[model samples]
Target: MLSGLLMIVDMQNDFVTKNGSLYFPQAEKVKPVVIDIVKDRMKREYDLIFTKDWHDPNDLEFKRFPVHCIKETYGAEIFDDLKFIIRDYSKINFVMKKRFSAFYGTNFDDILKNLSPKHVEICGVDTNICVMYTVEELKNRDYDVVIYENGVASYDEKLHEFAISQMRDVLGAKIEKWRSFNAQH
Candidate 1:
């Protein structure tokens, strides 16, 4: 079994694209870093797991945030920049989520039980919301987590910084520059 998991969370068009309704403004800056990490991790044979914000048009989440990433819409698709890097669609493990936390109402926990990686490395948008919530759950389950500082971004700078601090300080996650470590088996 693959010894580690690389989670690319919420890297969908609606969150990363400029034309997206709920676009993270700094998403473009983080895109290349994310892609590079993905490429590097792929070469190392880490299990690649991606999470998408798949929601119904009437999802309750739309009440708090703008309507976006509705299931089957172009906006809900993976970002074009990241799509090309996927060499085998069958090998990719996709978790479709409706809430902020990927583990919420999803088979993510079961997937984790099967993969049982030594650690989980994460990258993606909305550092304070989706990313943070997911990390919180992972930590709750006692998974060693590493958050790629350059590979994650948010629309709000303050919230982003706060989330990073909480993930590192409180949640006990390692916050590192992307690709700073060698691949582990």
Candidate 2:
């Protein structure tokens, strides 16, 4: 078994809250599980990170979603209920993101490289998009990866299931539940 980090995706207010333009209530629904996972990781002395969508309201992405994550905006912060204890600031780096994919134009990869965790357990919003890209990047780099199915939520169940299914069969990732951490694959 390899050491791991919980790479939480963008669970920001803009894309998740009901009042936000690109709301995904489902995203809010699975948040507790994600938080629980982080809490568990902390107990194991593993890294726990959250990716923030720190964007300009005027950016191109707003043209498509109409929601924003501008700096200092309520929409830019992590969801209120999902906040977990910070075991160590060094292990819990928050990557500010401008686009849907947290990897682009961000030192997210560098942070992960520094941590050198062999397995990355990803969870959070938009399973078919950001989550998929993150896992793909990790796979390309030959990093061990797993996705906690119960720890994430998406706008559509089909896309969510399809994305994980494809990742499992094609990307060679292991898809399991939030509590799956306690068991061996």
Among these predictions, the greatest lDDT belongs to 1
**Highest TM-score model number:** 1
Off by over 4 Å in 1: 180-185
lDDT of each: 0.90, 0.78
Displacement of residue 147 (Cα, Å) in model 1 is 0.5
Clash pairs detected, candidate 1: none
- lDDT by residue (1-185, candidate 1, tens digit) is 64988999899999889899888679998888888888888887888899999999999988888999999999998899789888564447999999989998999999999998999999998899999999999999999999999999999899999999999999999999875434432
> Per-residue alpha-carbon lDDT of model 2 for 64-156, expressed as tens digits?
776577878888878776653453345687888776666789998888778888888888887888788778878888878889898877899
Return the lDDT, model 2, position 132.
Answer: 87
- The true-versus-predicted C-alpha distance at residue 169 of model 2, in Å, is 1.7
Clashes of 2: 0
For all predictions, the C-alpha RMSD in Å is 2.5, 2.9
